[model samples]
Target: MRWPAKLPAGTLNRSIMSAMDVFPTLAEAAGVEIDSPFELNGRSLWKALRDGKREPRKDWLMFASETPIRGHFNVTAFNDEWKLVQEIDQGLLGADVRTHLFQIEPDPNEHNNVAAAHPDVVEEIGEAIHRWRMLYPVSGTRHELVPPPGWRAPKDWAGYPVAVGDLQDEPAPGMPPPFALPTLDWQHGEAGRLIYDCEPYAFLGGGLCK
Candidate 1:
């Protein structure tokens, strides 16, 4: 990965940008115009590269880092300093469905959960996320996006069924087996069809569906 000698060495921006930016950036570089009604979600880095600035061209950048189809449904909104991680989906225990705020300058690792300390920042960023979602409403049914009970990963062809509960309680191979069979309370009506609900289910503090 050798950078061209003609381009100067410098950090472009601290804000996050998606790979989706490439299309428009290349279009701009080629002197192509985007149709009026069509718009690109990312800004071109050409100007920033030409100027060698650390600041982002836009005041803020918003995008979903993970979608429900992949596994987790989360949206992130960030500016130069603050990053807000909004959990649009809920996990099995509904623990993952909460707002998390971090100061990018100090907490680049995003280990700290400052949503409790700065309620105002949470609300502000939350509203921004809401506005962004409103502008570009997510397509497809919400139910199919939500994960099912005890669904940790995409269903595999291997017949190893994953149980969602106190795994610690599963007895050792040498130990005496339990008398009863394990039961799972899955959504009854949504057997073959996808259920589209943006609500989180917290049955035993597991499950990542929203």
Candidate 2:
């Protein structure tokens, strides 16, 4: 909500809105024209806000990592009732991939993995993700997923910190299995450079690297 003189002031609708909505929404509110051939992925919330409706403005919203195809692909789609998290190349290390489901209302903490109990819901949400990806495919990257040795977090929350000492081997909840550098079998060279063979059908640089 903005405090500007032109904007409305009220408790607006409860909705799962995407960050993508900001561009078009702000444009319309400011009486600016955005001429385009492509259909936008987001809708403006101005109508619901102007009418003072408390209903949801959108049915669902999507969240994903920028380089989903590059490495540790993480994508999530959620509605008012449920959420689905799909992880690929888990931990940005190797090929452990899977999906987990959660009931948003009851499991506020998102601790319990109800996927086993609610296969139908899992299938439904998974289809939604599939459709969305088909419409707007995930992007790619040239750099390797994991960084070289001696790489440290640039910011406070950057790199994943491994547990040490007594708790070193314990698995962190909701996180994929810890990455063992040895498991990757990366061939190390001078100046800390590392290399690995791409899979036979591995997709990279907008095509198969092999």
- Say which candidate scores most in TM-score: 2
Clashes of each: 9, 0
Best model number under lDDT:
2
Predicted candidate 2 versus true structure: per-residue lDDT over 98-207, tens digit per residue = 88999988997999889999999989888888788776655432333444432333223343342222222433333223363232223222222122333323223121
Q: What lDDT is obtained when candidate 2 is compared to the true structure? A: 0.59
- The alpha-carbon deviation from the true structure for residue 207 of candidate 1, after best TM-score superposition, in angstroms, is 14
10 residues in a row with least lDDT, candidate 2? 187-196
Predictions in order: lDDT:
0.57, 0.59
What is the C-alpha lDDT profile of model 1 across 127-182, one tens digit per residue? 88888878765443243444433333324436344333313343334332233211
Model 1 poorest 10 in a row by lDDT = 180-189
TM-score of 1: 0.54
Cα RMSD to native, each candidate?
10.6, 12.6
Once fitted onto the true fold, the runs of candidate 2 whose alpha carbons sit more than 4 angstroms away are 3-13, 55-59, 66-71, 90-95, 135-210
Q: At residue 204, give the lDDT of candidate 1.
A: 58
